[model samples]
Target: MWTTLITLAIGAFGAVAAFWLGIPAPFLTGPAFLVTLCGISGIRVAIPARLRDVIFLIIGTNMGTAVTPEAVATAGKWPLSLIILSLCILAIFLIGARLLQMWFGMDRMSALLTATPGHLSFVIGLTDDLKADISRVTLISSLRVLTLTLLVPFIAPLLTGEPLPRLAPATQPMALPALAAILILATALGLLFQRLRVPAALLLGGMAVSSLAHAFSITEGSVPQWLSLPAFATMGALIGTRFGGVSFRMLAQAMGASATLSSFAAIVSLAGAYAVSQLFGIPIVTVLIAFAPGGLETMMAMSVLLDANPAYVAAHHVFRLVFLTLVLPIVVSRNR
Candidate 1:
């Protein structure tokens, strides 16, 4: 118990430091501290099994509640637009990855997958399986996320000065019965998805089920803001943990190539987003989050902080995630 308390305190302090230093919000302190604790003790601290479940549940619930019927209606009208935009983004990444591979003489699969700009772990795992250069891939992927997280929040404001509207705060206290129903439903959905081997099942499936409930007017209560705080913190900490095992020697070797790939990817993504924004008549911030090469948690936090449409931002990024995952292997194989 005492160890847990100490861990929590350290995590909080790290988060506070990051925030003060103008690090992107959704500060990830928990994972950072866990990594630190592991380093200090020379033993891995087992994350309570329940904690992982809770994190995914929270993520799923938040995502599920985010989408409203209105958002769906808007998406329906421009069905082909989202598809076209996603394909364009995927193509850009593939081309950029190939260029980097040729320039740096890096492993083709690793460079291609690292430039995917979606889930880092998934990309890393796939690259490793393909016997690609894990070190270079990991470095470039991490740098891509970090660069995007830092750049978008600063650049977005310049492009879209007017803050987006926020979700109105809940006024009435949530009834216990409604909250209980939501939990039960979300849990069942998450379990089903897990059983079915769905990707990020807990998050994606839970959110889908919860959103369906919301749309059907089965649950009108909003997710308690308190629940989201830890979820975001956990996400941030996990991102920071990626740095724990990295060495200066490895980073030094990869730095030039990583920087070049990251910069090129960012520029192309931003330009694609700009063109899409004009074509679709959507807000620029939405385009930015959709095309921004970073973690989902970081993008969502920026969406909230910038007062942009969280649902739009979430949808856009999710769209990209799905797109990249599906198209990357096919593109790489064809080109090879």
Candidate 2:
């Protein structure tokens, strides 16, 4: 308990420092960088699971406000990009599996599970049931998310060549009564998705409810900054906690594997994004976010930060998860 508090304090310091330094996505990246250092240095850091869920719900609900009439009109442009996105995930999965097997000394099952993009909870469950090395999979996957979280902000700007737009939070925040009612409905639907084994259930539920409300003008304002700022910080801190209890030596052993897989997957994502951008006239960077092979929660949160098309980015990620769910077992079973 004390450790968690200390970790959060360190994370808070990181957030303040990043904001002071004018770093992009300060609230999200600051704590993540600092807490990750603390974690790698062998400190005990943690974010409670419930708090993590709150982060998801708030961010997801906030994302719903990005659904505008313009975004709706762009729906026609998404199918081509999504189709390219499907191919990108396949390339990442197949090449990543082979890369791990060839260079990292990981067995097929371990490599396959480690290389599979997104769906960490589902992959970990498979590791246990399939008798693969849980630690290796966890480490590699965590490293991927951490590395992307740290690198994307800096790298994405270079790729896009356009200054990020500043979209202020809504002037009027959601009413307390409406916020509470929305959360209750989101949580109820989230629980239903959880029972059905859906990935990012709480997030999707919040997004679904909020999107519907905003679409119909039932909800009048966005999630408040008071809630969102802390949520982003907590998210960054939670990301850093992914490395807690891991040794430097163990991390060193996995870094090469993680880096190789991460680079390859990123390349595939970039390529697909470029193709879609050409085909559809969408910003390459926005398409890149949609194609990024990272956690749905994290990527969606980043989308909110970047002010990308939430409906577009969220749709691709949700599709990626569904695609992975249906295809992973078949790929593994056939190979085995």
Candidate 3:
């Protein structure tokens, strides 16, 4: 309990420092950077599964709040963008896996799982079943997520020519009754999704339910800043915790591979984003945030930072995740 408190405190402090320094998306970058340092320095940082799930519920519900009728109208372009996103994911996985195999001499299974963008937990869990290299997979993946988390805030502004404020602006808060209703429904739906073996089940469930409610004019308010800011902080901290128990030597060895793969995935994602933008008239920044090969949670946070339509951005990411969930299992079975 003391350890959890200390770890959370550190994450909070990181947010304060980042905000004080006027960094964009401070609640995210700050906690992510600091707690990652704590994890690597062997300072002992851990977020319990229950607490983590609660954070997801909050963030998922918050994201749902951003759904307006205008956003629903804009979603018409999503199918084409989603098709393009699928192609990008395929490119990143196939090319990256081959690179890992050729350059690092990683085994086929390990390389394949390692090359998979996002869906880190799924990959790691499969490592044991497939007898793959958990250490290699974890090291490369941790770096990829961390690199993207730290990189996107700086990159999104430069790419979009839109300057994000250092702090997210306050909005009207959600009514408690409505909030409770959404959460209860989200939880029920999330559990159903989870039982069906869906990735990001809770988050997706919350988003789906919340979007429905918002679209129906059931509620019209933003997630309270007090709830959102800390949830964002926790999301960042979760990224950093990926480094806990990782060895420095392993991190160093995987650096080149992770960097190369991250760069390649980003380039492919950028190209796909560009193509979708041209085809559908969506902003490249928004598409990129959706199509970026980062984790769903990290990219969701980036969507908020980019001030893009959260529903539009998150839907693509959810598709990417759900697509990966289906694809990864097939590859594993085929290779075996």
Candidate 4:
């Protein structure tokens, strides 16, 4: 459709502009801001959800390449930080839900779903089945992502008191035979996870399979530039499309509350990041980006942009998503 083409053009412009201006994660921040402007203006633009899943598969495959044998060994020490991260996730969930309930007078189901940090689509999908406030849940979830995506780059440097590392674009290419084998394995695993009803199964499954192959010296190199770059661009477009039906008036009234709660979540994320950094000897900023409560793809893109460990960042986000998806539903169901 013409509208979709126009939307992509606007996103492309944003990406070029951001890169020209040297903003952090230009590909993501640019398209997200531009498409959000188009969406809020009532423009009819969209990206199919199925395409977004394909992008995630590519990103997951790319991230898995970072999992060398030593990285797998290091993961043995991740249990402590991961456990702390889980508790931090719980705190964020409870605090956010309570704030939404107390300040906005939202019911338990809506508040709990809206307060959850990730799995935006799955939570929104529950609205009709649970008779929750679809508008409030969508708005709050959208705001959380937009707020974090726009703010994290600025906040990250300040919190870590260090300059962001130089950009590192992966340029290596895997042979066609190796690439085909890796894709087949990853895709099969992704499909299997989907059958098991796992949240972000496509991403985590692909990542797990790819990581295993690489760790065992099966796959030789990274995902091709052709696949990875487009995946990143499409991911950016998806983030921007989130604002499609949101109104300025709705955001105006909820801005204060949402902003406060989002800030609290950010602070909590940073605290957890610091703890994990100290405990694991990783850079504070790296861990901070890893623990950032944004989309797994977006945060991993940030890690790639900031020259952080994308595998580590992806692992934390995947865990956060799975844990939230599993626990949030139960909590809401009990309260209801």
Q: Count the backbone clashes (under 3 Å) in each candidate.
A: 2, 0, 0, 0
Compose the digit string of candidate 1's lDDT tens values, residues 300-322: 65554444556676676777767
> Candidate 4: how large is its RMSD?
2.2
lDDT string for model 4 (94-190, tens) is: 9888988898888878888878887887787777679688887888778788888878777777877775543455656778888778778888898
Where is model 3 more than 4 Å wrong at Cα? none
Q: Give the TM-score of candidate 4.
A: 0.91
lDDT for 188 in candidate 2 is 92
Task: Provide the overall lDDT of each model, using Cα atoms, as 2-decimal numbers.
Answer: 0.63, 0.84, 0.85, 0.78
> Candidate 4, which ten residues in sequence have the lowest lDDT sum?
163-172
Give the TM-scores of the predictions, in the order they appear.
Answer: 0.80, 0.95, 0.95, 0.91
Best by lDDT: 3
Off by over 4 Å in 4: 129-131, 169-171
**Superior by TM-score: candidate 1 or candidate 4:** 4
Off by over 4 Å in 2: 165-171
**Candidate 2 structure quality by residue, lDDT tens digits, 1-336:** 798789779988998898888676778889998998899898889998888887888888888877777787889887777788888888899889999999988999899999998888878866655868899999999999888777777767788776553233445788989988888899999889989988888988888898888888887787888887777788889889999988899999999999999999888888888888888888766787788888888888878777778888899999998998899989877766
Worst 10 residues of 1 by lDDT: 163-172
Instruction: Score candidate 2 by TM-score against the native.
Output: 0.95
